[model samples]
Target: MAVVRPVRGDRVRVYDLQVQGTSNFFAGQVLVHNCLIVDDPHKDRADAESEASRRALHDWYSSTALKRLQPDRNAVVGIQTRWHPDDFAGRRLAEEGRLEEGGRWKVVHLPAVADAKFGADPLGRAPGDPLPHPKIPTRDRKALKAWWADMKRTSIVRDWHSLAQGDPQPAEGALVSEELLRLLRDSATKVEPQKIAVAVDPSGGGRDVAGVVGGFLGDDKRVWITHDVSAVMSSADWSTAACRLAYEANAAIIYVEANYGRDMCSLAIRTSWETLQRDGEIPENVLMPAIDLVTAKQGKLLRAEPVAQQMVQDRVRLRGLFVDLEREWSTWMSTDPDSPGRIDASCILTYGLIPEANKGAIVHAPLPQAPVSGGRGPSQVAGAYGRRIGK
Candidate 1:
């Protein structure tokens, strides 16, 4: 053992020491070992929420920290509170499955209150039971309940779920539920649809992926989502994709969100349709689906609420599984900085199919009808297009 004393100086020099057999040393009163320990890698809530920050942390762990570990003797451990879905804890869980599912890491999740939705609580507490605290007496149930109630009352829903519940997303805030979607899934073959539509949410040259989704109003009066081909693409590519989906679905109309570039958005679809016809992608005999420009007069959340309600009421069904689109719908939060493109397209598709869902949030205007050929009007063309595909 050695006696240590502090020395006063203008500038202090630091040195690293290697322990003999134990490979461990004492700093002040705490034991320092040769294992990697990451404690709250994110500086704050803002950093946790930033994608760049999360990437930087993950990069350092993968590129630098892991390399320093001793193959047999060292281990890695991360301790953090849930901040965002892409936070370190979340990224790890996503990359490597959860422990129960055979992940490499062992997770000990303790929420402020027990929520069965997350998983079984280690403390054996039932749902709604407050976590036991050493500072508070064990017998004080009333005090613990009051404390948790106050916390929930003061904190926002997202924060309460992330910080208190150890869950980044709460079902209360999501636009749709994966469970409900799964339950509504239809396994039967496609049936005749009264009307079909393709909806587009343009990227407007931003980082967002353009959203192109197709659905049909079935004889049962339910909106059935049949296609989702959202992707990061150029203007021409997305417009072409939207037009192609419309043609394949025999959609009577194509609805496009004109929030970013109103005239330009409609123009892109029209140009793509015309080009497809010229290139023989669409038959010359089949008239192009009518293009309707939808200008959003309300916030994204406000416009989406009615559609979400429609789903809850069993008015919306999935013809098949759309994994990526469903993920966006289930995990997207109202507080997220960027609006998810898939969800935007879905809202447009739903509102277009079920006009009653609009509720004044959107104003629709049809583009000038393509010159009718052979005495076929827009209505007659639409009727023809509405016929079931492959019938």
Candidate 2:
């Protein structure tokens, strides 16, 4: 073990990278003075063979954490970690090696399910009051214990950067594995889809394969992806296939990524429907499927995170085997998604399933200025007497 560096003016702090971890770990007090910034316990764990080398100047700010004796301004932190591709909190930490704990968060870090330490080195002399160890189960669950044991060695280069030092990548946290998927796949439908939609991603260049996916929002609030119609078809062909899939799946909406050309994509689908009619491919009685045009202001990885989160929440399912589709998901990188069409279509499908009432980033935007009740003030002369109240 390395000699511990002295941290000046320190408090007993429990930080979190997320709101859940923050709320869970923070069980302490903060008083003025005797404050310390940090001590670099472990060097930014460098990758011997790659550009993962760490330096004092580069990590002087982000890589540092505090260490001090008891009864100070620190609490035993709890890190509530759930692996998902849409882990915005994780991504923020990964990018630029730090995010300002934005969202009005007071502190940051995840809760440890087990011991928080390096090899044989416990969490300083100030991990918890009166004891060096955290309050964890005597026998931690086997699966969780395994993750903690191998947290460093098991994760890929991308993930180690984010989870360890807050260095994020597009492909870091979405927790999907071949084993997990295989275990969940079914030979028969277990439930019926309450609502159906066909999500499409049309590429700007003809060389790219257009991604088309069909999903059903089940009564159980689980999104079961049923089909993948992604192919290297011309504009008219892909549109026609998407329309056909909508009819086959009894889908009510054809959600299309309108980023490249909104009108052209929408019109192409409709025109394809008409062409289908001309060829007697689709029944004349069926009206053209409705278009739900979607645009993307965020990057592909950002869009993917929420949907990947659905999988982590067990709110997403795969009705049948989607070998190629799952392959896209497994290899999809966060910084630059590989098979973007497949992932984009997947996002649209899951997003459509997200309840209308529960959508978008939850913000604490200040309320519009409204006159205070009781003539603007009662006890403190209009709350501040038109001047700053505190130093």
Candidate 3:
């Protein structure tokens, strides 16, 4: 037998539009009277696009509404999932102070959504009568169980789409906060001009521009990045540019990656610094330390993870002089694997200064112990005398 479904609603009709749900926005305006509440808490492409979608919905409602849509009153709650609080609702609340810490607009953590009842109860009827809301396709326990199996196969951080907004499953991993990411972006854009450091990732063939990332480490152990400059040139050419940048920024150290260009690149950069000093081009107060080589054996991803985590955790701060750095970071994160060059190089430089987080807990290398020699010395010594004293 076929059942008839109603197109319009009387008053409050509950709809479940699930993951990547957008139809609800238009459907709600057409059928229901309430604003859409997305339970998605993770930062996904959907969340990234939410702000635009929200704007479109608002526009549609304002123009399309027969009566007042009450833009200010329509509240969307993205609960349960751990995502950047900077999402459409979160940022609006932050700026307006309309949402309080424990208020209605809050990021809630629960054992599981199943622990709480979802969807509308049709049995609890009112005088206006009832209508069924369209159900949105959601990732259920079966899909989540599958996602949990998949998570074991790869680094979850690399798969933000899955980890952030994929199947909601419990993983023994801590997710990075959006507030922290905002803080890093804010900090990087505000790096101070006086204290800075430039770490070079050199390209010797003159084909690829040597990357020079400029940032300063503050007394509070926060790093403020100012610039990330990459251009094609000879070692000397880049050295000259680096020196100028360092001088202008009053950078403390010039760290040159000595693996590819080896000692030659380091010497070239030092020589350029000296040339500027001799010509009285650089100020006396601006101290340029000797080139220091970072000798940690780790992949780019491994080395960069801590820095990224720190940025997302508010552990590292970018000061006022880092306009360029902030731009690069936003671009790099949005599109990873393609243009991570400047961002990667900058992260390496940041780690060079703040090594503790990267180094983690130190394990003591075994030391060579002295040989024990307390055997029988003479013919008279026997039995117990034959035993070693410090064996």
TM-score of every prediction relative to native: 0.57, 0.47, 0.42
Residue range 154-204, candidate 1, lDDT tens digits:
776777887788887634456676566666677463445778899999963
lDDT of each: 0.71, 0.53, 0.48
Off by over 4 Å in 3: 1-180, 185-196, 277-280, 283-288, 321-324, 327-339, 360-391
Per-residue lDDT tens digits of candidate 2, residues 1-391? 1122343223212232212221223323433222332222222222211122223322432444423323433332213222332232332244524214343233343333212331121333223212212445534445444555466566655545455434334432333554445544543444545667899888824577778999877555667788998887788878888988987776777888766778988889989888887889877776665788776535665566556555655567777778767766654554433445777788777776664312444222112221111222222211211211222
What's the true lDDT of residue 187 in model 2? 38
RMSD of each: 13.8, 23.7, 19.4
Q: Write the per-residue lDDT of candidate 3 for residues 137-174, one digit (tens) a residue.
A: 23343555445445444433434433433232222122
Backbone steric clashes in candidate 1, count: 0
Candidate 1 residue 192 Cα shift, in angstroms, is 2.1
Candidate 2 RMSD to the real structure? 23.7
**How many clashes does each candidate structure show, in the order listed?**
0, 28, 16
**Candidate 1 or 2, higher lDDT?**
1
